[model samples]
Target: MNPRDTEEMTATMKRELLCVLLLCGAVFTLPGQEIHRRFRRGARSSRVTCRDEKTQMIYRQHESWLRPMLRSNRVEYCWCNSGRSQCHSVPVKNARATCYKDLGVTYRGTWSTAESGAECINWNSSLLARKSYNGRRPDASKLGLGNHNYCRNPDKDSKPWCYVFKAGKYVPEFCSTPVCSQEKNGDCYFGKGLAYRGTHSLTVSGTSCLQWNSMVLIGKINTAWKTNAQTLGLGKHNYCRNPDGDAKPWCHVLKDRKLTWEYCDIPQCSTCGLRQYKRPQFRIKGGLFSDITSHPWQAAIFVQNRRSPGERFLCGGILISSCWVLSAAHCFLERYPPHHLKVVLGRTYRVEPGVEEQKFEVEKYIVHKEFDEDTYNNDIALLQLKSDSPQCVQETGSVRTVCLPEADLQLPDWTECGAFWLRQARGVYNAPSLSFLTASPFYSERLKEAHVRLYPSNRCTSQYLLNKTVTSNMLCAGDTRSGGNQANLHDACQVNMSVSPYSEPTPG
Candidate 1:
């Protein structure tokens, strides 16, 4: 697939400073009410709980696995040659059949023999999973070794495989299972190869790949990211993957016995998703006053003021690709001509240009066809940057594209919400999380981020929203605690988001 087509990562939600800010600081508006503080700290008495759609799907998938496996043949094997070795049998609950290639990821059958007709070594064997390969014990949960000697594929192998005793040592061999077919590459991957599940463990120079869940490689990639290894689909087996938004599938390989990262030389059914830059060495840091370098994907959008010499801050956008900026549809409802708008990338200050900043004129914009100005439903817009070159902006220290969210992410109920700020004059307010109800003028010149939390679906219903229609796409967030920062929020966005006396007819 074209990298441009794949780079529409953040375009999924189409948020900007004003839109994404959502209710980070809780200046929400209901149709009949002037303004409503969407959040109030210590007010969980009336709060409703919610489980996102992804959670429901996974729960359903697990329920489906129970029925068919009970009818399959159960097997038993002795796990180790050690004095403590004991014969164990497959547990009924974990037994699974692979009907499709994608099912290979979730396959948990009790087939314990390898292609060489060798008995598969039990994962619990001291010489294998229990021993430290290189400073890290082989991860059992990551490898999906559920006690039995069942053949499994934790790595993206051609089919289900396991270690077997051969030639005085344990070696890996494929198993003939109905779950994952021997044909390796049949609908095995997802977009841009982030979900690449091929058996391409060799680098361009034919170096063998290290296990993705290897403690050494996990610590090398980013120690902080180790916890997220499973979430990124990195597991026990070493297979080339694009877990961190790289241009192509890659893995940590041993070169001259030193661990290093390299791109896999294996070719796929489709073209690799190319990008303008490589993954950064480290993750961005967070604080009250967000530096532009921490938010490389941010775009400072502005409108050419027809009545004045200078432009006015329109809205904050996020870079999805080298040439595309995703923002709210309401920001363009005025129908401003493309020539009248500009997008500044890699900017530090909101107004004063940063040394690494790159500016581009707006080429054109495409808003959701069903956008509702009144309800802000389908409130997404994509702006194309006018540029002479194909890559409108180069990926730099202060400029990069954000990865599109594909997996469940498994965020908590109180997910962090931030507002990307844009102000006219250079001013700094060392504050936390920002929000807005309307366009405000008194924001600080420095890019500001506000810490915000998500609200349950019940709290953001039409009855609570002044009878305005609320859609699934529209998220409600806010700061529940009312404290010293209220003054800063009042002055920062300069928005009159305070609740009106009449708006609050009920005591609750």
Candidate 2:
């Protein structure tokens, strides 16, 4: 077919954009246009049987306007539940916080494995095929739970826990999320951290910290964070702390879960520069969309709403460590309380449950003290995940931390790096009736990476960068190919729905 045919087809398909108030428990997509039409017809019959006059009226009012356009071969479709009870209209808000810390309540990130290495049982699973349940289960959406078996803390437990099928019973098991008694800020270590008493018990590689006092230790749990135990800062817990005067904080954590103790991967506080600085990569230049296998350090962040039900996707982050995520300062401009954020790692798909996904509650929030929202300088923020035991997140094949680029490290110009991007909108503005379809959040449902390159510093000067001021801290990088040479990068700048760590080119 010629380009004219494609143009005509696209124009005809988007002739009318209509918003049908389709209500449903979860977003469900159709296999193809043929299936969508078939299912849409079946949904029409629900107008009366479904007993939802209001929704039927709203759909029917636009049906006449949408009939001709819906018949187009190029259109896609997805049917929603006819019941009003199942429908949840998410209030659209400008995303700010890089993460959210809830009461272990509406957790949506996919972290399904239990602390005991047991896989969580799905909420909608038929394992309890019998009529009565041992305990009442809350609505899956209440905790941002899909039908999948991802772990969540519904009862406001000390940490996120899920039920595992044991023998004939569903036994509850806690995930790696920090418990209230043992949770603490895992980010900073000041002046040897002698007085820091929070329990953060894991090594950088997810190893449990060894107790200074071997006698009173029960498991990796510290009995007292006291100096009287005569070891180092052996206290009630084996959390990471600096009892001995060292350059940075260190602890004797069990290496590889063995009896032998080895100390490594302990976070060193950045005494000089800030750890929140984020390198901007607008779009992947040559590569379009890659997956977690390629960019294991990529992280997705979300914020919980107090007045609303489901969590909202806020921004993308780079996992610098197991317990810390780095994003842009603008992502947290609204000044969301530290507890309103949670980070998800190892999730290949935005909403789909990943088998090895891990979720963490934010324990500390740090934005650049000198951030300039106007100039976009210092556009960085750091989120500290609450420590549960020792490590906040377990490293997985799809969820490993990225190494910090060395200051003295040398690389050639145009050095390519991984990037996260949102799909740009096509100029297919149909009639105002279908505005919802044009702005639907369902597009780009999976995690993707784009290839972007590091240009020579001399070439990225103010004269070459659209006359924007080249701040000392700012880095200029984006796709420069013919079709992708648009100056702006990162979808958060355009879309009001989903946000990502980004800043305007430092204004001249």
Candidate 3:
């Protein structure tokens, strides 16, 4: 009973082992079939033409595997190099087929069918034919052909060539005119898309157009001429128009690669009208006599006396321009007529006349419009002189014009300035008839100048003027030194004479 059971069990185990081996073999064969299917599909999709005998024989070995995948009913094969046929066979690709139909007649049989199979039939024979013809003819006959014509056939052959009749030669085709054309009028044309159209002149180069932003200066042109503002394509707000005739010529500026007319005059220095003469380096402190040339712009103003017919010295002035004199407006307290006033320049002595002294009559007097009599605010006045020539006092070593301070000029507090004037003093003398009689003050008779420092506005307020309105325009000057008796005080008591009866008088 044990032997029979062992034999049956061995047979069943053999059968089970054989079934497992067969299942493993089937699993491996499925992948091989899938691989074969993929290879056949690829071969059928690509139209590979094999012209060489060796290549044809190799392809035949693979045909059987690929034939089942082919869907086309009719198929012809030819050797193709870069999509063009290498043999005498026609191209099957749609693009190459069309190209053969258009230009094949020109280069037919010119190429070998199968010498080395390296050169193929160029289906685009029209391009090859045009290139061949172009090399044989003069460049003038092909001027109309664009640069791209080298790779493709031009649409038409009879297009006009860019030939110059006078030069008897052809030029290359251009997108626009290379040179500017002068019109019947003064305007000119400098190619298309350039804002320089209608310009008087233009500059350019062979390879490129003129830079549209380049600037051209036409000097000293009358600004009255109508400007070509619109043609330049500049906005109106970008420039200023000078209607005043005294303004300088305008300049044309290039903006945004376009010409823009604008005001080009450089701002003149405020010191331009100032005399260039160097000031005397040797300066003196305290009250001292000044040379006539040292203060050439100094002036002595005289007014006709109402009681006496003779003129009387009134005040001092400064010559600021060729025909204008600046002085304290309060000097005209009597409201004297302009004809009654006279200006004496280059005078060193108060009474005696100087050699370089020039006299001038006043044509007009203009006190500051905002002058205040009580506070002496805006005490300046301009006197226009009456003269035969345009200039009143000829500029000389002793009669040059002085520079007027700018309106915004500021000097630090305590800045020393020379104050020129004539000083007078009186000495009491004992007499028999009177207890003490005072003689008329002895006039200095010479131009004396004193160094005075400017006082800060805060220190020169209404409080110092006894509650008087000390306006902003009013300026205060005083001696900067303290606690010292002024030996030769000049005009120190001019404002304090009311407080002290014995104060010295100052006349300027």
* Top-scoring candidate (lDDT): 1
As for model 2, its CA RMSD to the true structure in angstroms is 33.9
lDDT of 3 by residue, 297-335 (tens): 777888888887798777777676767876666677678
**What CA root-mean-square deviation does each model show from the true structure?**
33.6, 33.9, 30.1
lDDT winner between candidates 2 and 3: 2
lDDT digits (tens) for residues 103-157 of candidate 1: 3655665667666777777665656744332111224434556455777667666
Q: How close is every model to the real structure, measured as TM-score?
A: 0.38, 0.38, 0.37
Top-TM-score candidate index:
1
lDDT of all the models against the reference? 0.55, 0.51, 0.43
Clashing pairs in 1: 9-404, 23-477, 31-466, 41-480, 98-179, 433-450, 433-451, 434-450
Model 3 has a clash total of: 2
CA lDDT for candidate 1: 0.55
Deviation in Å, model 2, residue 427 alpha carbon: 28
Q: How many residue pairs clash in all the candidates, one count each? A: 8, 27, 2
Tens-digit per-residue lDDT, 202-305, candidate 2: 65566777666656344544334342332234444566666555554456654445555433354433332122322333433223344564456667788987
lDDT order, best first, reads 1, 2, 3
Candidate 2: what lDDT? 0.51
